[model samples]
Target: MNVAVEGRIEKRHISLSAKAKAYVALTKPRVIELLLVTTAPVMILAQNGIPDLWLVVATLVGGALSAGSAGAFNCYIDRDIDRVMKRTQGRPLVTGELTDREALVFAWVIGVASIVWLAIFANFLAAALSLVAILLYVFLYTVWLKRRTSQNIVWGGIAGCMPVLIGWAAVTHSLSWTPFILFGVVFLWTPPHYWPLSMKYRDEYKAANVPMLAVVRGRAVVGLQTILYAWATVACSLLLIPVAPMGIVYSVVALASGAWFIYETHRLYNRAIHGHEVKPMRVFHASISYLTLVFLAVAIDPLLPF
Candidate 1:
């Protein structure tokens, strides 16, 4: 009897631990990390230095909750198609680790919590922007656009750009032209960043009946579109040099990273036009590294003595 009780207790503990991990996975922590990366740097730039420690923490926590809420809602909405796509097949909803109802409730709870947190700790503007971000991701991107249009990610990506504005609002409690330029950088960057993933998984998106650009258009068209967007993204990043009047650090990093990004996109285009087997994941990986480097410069440039 004692041994059976102990065994049951251990099993229950393990089950609870697994459930917790599933809940975390449902939040899509990696996506939240990317959002937070944009947030902190913008906050630094807004203040023209590091803001208060607590305000930074509060805003980041709020941003993470909001991004997590969006991710959870996305998982619930896409659960059916997620099951069909190999890349998303392991998500909590598809894996049966989380029920759609549970995920939906979690999304609401965290979504509301994020707004309240930002309002109390950061500012009203920050809170409002976060609310807009949640709604945009849930409705505009996921519900209205994702399946209906091949240009889905092009507009859906606006939700991802909100972190920059939210971070600026947190520090300055306002809006400005500089953050809008940053916003453009991200908006244009999204296509090249995400389309490659879609390209690599073209068949999966097709099987799921999602209208990703890669599925709707031929490979060469998608590649050409990616290059166009990559160039526009680089152009927008350079605009910050004069707009924010950024110094050498940001200017150099932006130029170098943007060149590398454009180079990778050209490589994709070259392969597509030549009718060779295109390795899109290389461009996809390069896009992430490029964005990271550019933003790293954004965060560091303001702190320099020169």
Candidate 2:
């Protein structure tokens, strides 16, 4: 009897542990991390220095919850295409680690809780923006656009851009040209950032019948588009120096990193134009590095006396 009781206890513990992991997976923690990366630095910039540490913590948590909620909805909605796509095959829903009902309930619970958390700890504007982000990502991007258009990610990218406004609003309870300019920087950055990854997985999208630019358009065309967007992103990054009066650190890092980002983009374009093997992942990785460095500089700039 004692041995059976111990065995049952161990099994239950293991089951609970697995359930926890599946729920965490449903949150799409990696995407949440990237979204949060844009959050805190903007909070720093919004405060014009380091803000209240606890407020930063609260805002980050709420933002993570909100992004996770939206990601969960994406997973639930895309479970069909996800099953077909090799890259997304390991998602919790695709793997049967969670059910559609389970994912849906989780998304709603977290989504509502995130708004309440932000409203209580942050403010109404931050809470409201978070809710808007969730709605746009789920309704506009996932349901309406994901399968319907080659331009899905272009407009869907707007959902991701709201964090700057949310962060800025959290601090001041208001909006301004600065947040919008940073919003533009994020907006222009998304295509170049995402297109490379799409190019690398064009086959998967084709198999799923998702008409991504990389799947519908040739690599040469996608590469050219990337270059144009990359240049636009750089130009927008530079505009911060005048519009928001970003300091020397931000200007220097933005120019240098923007140049590097555009260079890698052109490299991909050149390879496509020359009939050489196109290295899409190089640009993909470079985009991540560029955004991280640029945002880190944003955080660092206001702390400086100059």
Candidate 3:
């Protein structure tokens, strides 16, 4: 009888651990990590140096919560489509690891808590922008735009840009041209960044009845658009050099990384227009590296003497 009780207790513990892991998965921690990557560097730039360590910690925590909330809500709303797509088939809701009601409740709890946390620990403006980010991501992007148009990511990407503003607002508690330039860089970068992923998964998107650009348009056209957006993204990144009065490190890194990003886009375009096997994930991974390097420069520039 005691052996039976011990076995049941161990099983219960294992079940609880699995449930906790599923809850964390609902928040899409990878996406939150990318959002937080953009957030901290902006805070560093806004300070023109290191700000208070506590403030940085507070802002990062709030930003992570806010992004996590948005991601969780996205998972909940898209659970049906997620089930239909191969890439998303392992999501908690799709796997029945978490109920829809539980996911919805978790999203709301974190969403509200994020705003309140930012308000108390960061500032009102940071909190307000976080709220807007959540609304834009949940309503404008996920519900209203995603299924209706191929250009969904183009407009929905604004929500992703909000972290730069939130980061700046956390430090300075005000809006400025520099942060807006950073916002533009992200805005223009979104299409090229996301379209490559869509290209690789065009069939899945079509199967799921989602109108991603690669599904609705020919690969060549999508590639051309990616190239255009890539160029625009690089141009916008250069605007920061002048507007932010960026140092040599940022200026050089921005130019070099932006060029590499544009080159990758052109490579995609070449493969598409020529009817060669288009290895789009190359550009996709390249975009991630480019963004990380450029932003790393952003974080390092403010501390440089020159």
Candidate 4:
């Protein structure tokens, strides 16, 4: 009987671990990291230095829950297509690690928690923006656009830009040109940042019948669009210098990083047009680094002495 009891205890421990992993998987932690990266830097720039530490923590925790709720809902809504897509085949829903009903319930629980958390700690505006982010990502992007339009990620990217506004609002409890410019910077950057990743997994998207740009258009057109958006993203970054009166460090990093980003995007276009090997993921990863550098400079320039 003792041996049987120990065996039951071990099984229980294993079951709990599996459930823990499943819950974490629903959050899509990597995407949460990207969202939060953009958040804290904006808070820094908004405060013109480091903001209150607890305020930053509260905003970040609230934002994480909101973003995670969006991700969980996305997983639930897309589970059918996810089963077909090779890239998403390992997701918790697709793998049977979590039930659809459980995911849906978890989504609402965390989503509501995010709003309450933000309202109590941040402000109504930030909380409201968090609600908007969840709603936009879920209703506008996932339910409405993902399968219907090739330009889905373009317009859907608006949800991602909400973080900049949320971050800024967390500090000043107001709107300003700076956050709008940063919003534009992120809005324009998303397609270039995401399209290449989609390009890498184009077959999966095609198999899933989702209307990614790569599915509906050839590489030449996709590459051209990436370059155009790269130009716009860089242009928007420059606007912050004048709008915020950012100093030399930010200006230099913005120009340099933006130039590299544009060059890599142009290289993607050149390769696609010339029938050479196009390194799509290289451009994708570079775009992430570019944004990190630009935002880091945003946070730093505010604190630096000219």
Against the true structure, whose lDDT is highest? 4
* Cα shift from native, residue 288, model 2 (Å): 0.5
TM-score of each: 0.95, 0.95, 0.95, 0.95
Measured on C-alpha atoms, candidate 4 has an lDDT of 0.93
Find the number of clashing residue pairs for candidate 1. Answer: 0
Tens digits of per-residue lDDT, candidate 2, 1-306, equal 012474573322336677788889988998888888888999999898999999989999999999999999999998999999999998888776677999999999999999999999999999999999999999999999989998888999999998888888889899999889889988899999999999999999999999899999999999999999999998988888887779999999999999999999999999999999999999999998998998899899999999
In model 3, the Cα lDDT at residue 243 comes to: 85
The alpha-carbon lDDT assigned to residue 166 of candidate 4 equals 95
Q: What is the Å distance of residue 301 in model 2 from its true position?
A: 0.4
lDDT of 2: 0.91
* RMSD values, in order shown: 4.3, 4.6, 4.3, 4.3
Between candidates 2 and 3, name the one with more favorable lDDT.
3
Residue 43 local lDDT, model 2: 90
Q: What is the C-alpha lDDT of each candidate?
A: 0.92, 0.91, 0.92, 0.93
Give the per-residue lDDT of model 3 (tens digit) for 30-101.
Answer: 888878888889999999999898999999999988998999999999998999999999998887778898
Residue pair clashes in candidate 2: none
Cα misplacement distance, residue 164 of candidate 3 (Å): 0.2
lDDT of 1 at 68: 93
Clash tally, candidates in order: 0, 0, 0, 0
For model 2, the stretches where C-alpha displacement exceeds 4 angstroms are 1-14
lDDT of 4 by residue, 86-160 (tens): 888888887777778889999999999999999999999999999999999999999999999999999999999
Better by lDDT, candidate 2 or 1: 1
Summarize candidate 1's per-residue lDDT along 1-306 as a digit string, tens digits: 012474573322336777789889988998898888888999999999989999999999999999999999999998989999999989988766766788899999999999999999999999999999999999999999999999999999999999999999999989999999999999999999999999999999999999999999999999999999999999999999988979999999999989999999999999999989999999999988998888999999999997
The positional error of residue 272 in candidate 2, measured at the CA in angstroms, is 0.5
What is the TM-score of candidate 2? 0.95
